[model samples]
Target: MTQQKVALVTGGNRGIGKEIVKKLIEKDNAVIFTYRSNAKEAEDLIAEFESTGIRIKALKLDVSKIEEFESFSESINLILNEWQVTGIDSLVNNAGIGFFVPFEEATAAQFDEMLNVHFKGPFFLTQKLLSSINDNASIVNISSTATRVALPGFSVYAAMKSAMETISLYQSKELGARKIRSNSILPGPVATDFSGGAVRDIEDINSRIAQQHALGRVGLPKDIASAVAFLCSEDSAWIDGQAIEVSGGYM
Candidate 1:
């Protein structure tokens, strides 16, 4: 019998992360996802899948708090053992905060927060979970289109994502011996509650973003989630160390 696949996703309670979890589950992957502090939302996500006869689990994790990673790794090991899985087949580094501080006004604290959540957090968390990640596993980092397009009020945020993109390449290079593939997905402006929901709720901002895409519409969470699911599957096995833009032909 083919072994069931397992995935560990961060920030899987809402927005793009939530949609990624659902997509993976739809692909028959057993997901063990994390949410920072929303116990209620986490519970709802678990229950929603449970009612559909899909068993999934959620844990509380603050990616900004690197100190908690060791314990979190232990918790993940316990879950893997309970599920009778040797290791997770995929690790989706999807947890992130929306920081839009401009270059002139960005503060030290904001910069550090962005670094902690985007760069430091995923870097170390992947290191911590390395032993539990199966050989040939895929690591998908959720990046932003800000890395490509120059946008005001997004200097720090985009910088952090650029760092993430760099690390993803290094991860693919170093982990190649174990056949672990690492890649980044740069999603264009999506109508989500991220960034205070300006893209989703504000018609002017939404319409402006829509014009940048060839599809003539701002991306939805499922648009990015579908790409994530593809990367995690064996269908993308030959693809590695690449940063894919899932922005509906955003130029």
Candidate 2:
């Protein structure tokens, strides 16, 4: 009999994070995910999957607070106990906040928030959760293609994502003895509610962004989520320390 695999994703209540939860569940994996303050959205997602009879748990987590990671680890252990699993098989660092202010106008608060959410949060979360991840497990970091492209308003956010990519390479190397594979997925502009839904709600803005992509459209949550599912599966066992750009050929 094949045992069920467990996945942990941050900010799984909406956007690409929510879609990742859905795809992982569709793949027949149990999931424990986190959200910041969206209780209504989280509850709706949990209720949506209640009929499937698979394990699902969502908790409020602020990734910026590294001080809380120890307590968070305890909570994860409790979830694992309830799910009858000793360790999670996959971890997705997808929780984040968006900052679109131009670099010159970027405030200190915005810069620090971006740093903590995009870089420090994932770095420490994975470190604190290492003991709970099984051997040969997968870790996927959610990054942005802005790292390659010089987007004006995305300076801080893109820089932190770039740091995450670098951290992923080191994680893959250090965790190699345990066969843990770490990778990053860089998505082009997605038409989610992120950044106040500028891409999704404004037709002109969306068109401008879409024009940069060969696909002629901005991506959807499903577009990025599908890539996440692939990286978490054993099918990507040999793939590690790589940043895969799922941009539809966006320059």
Candidate 2 lDDT for residue 238: 92
Per-residue lDDT for 116-158 in model 1, tens only?
9999999999999999999999999999999999999999999
What C-alpha lDDT do the candidate models reach, one value each? 0.94, 0.94
Q: Residues 1-251, candidate 2, lDDT per residue (tens digit)? A: 67799999999999999999999999989999999998999999999978878789998899999998999999999989887787999999999988578978989998889999999999999999999999999999999999999978899899999999999999999999999999999999999999999999999999998998998889999999999999999899999999999989896
Q: lDDT score of model 1?
A: 0.94
Clashing pairs in 2: none
After aligning candidate 1 to the native by TM-score, how far in Å is the CA of 221 from where it should be? 0.2
C-alpha positional error of residue 170 in candidate 2 after TM-score superposition, expressed in Å: 0.3
Alpha-carbon runs more than 4 Å astray in model 1:
none
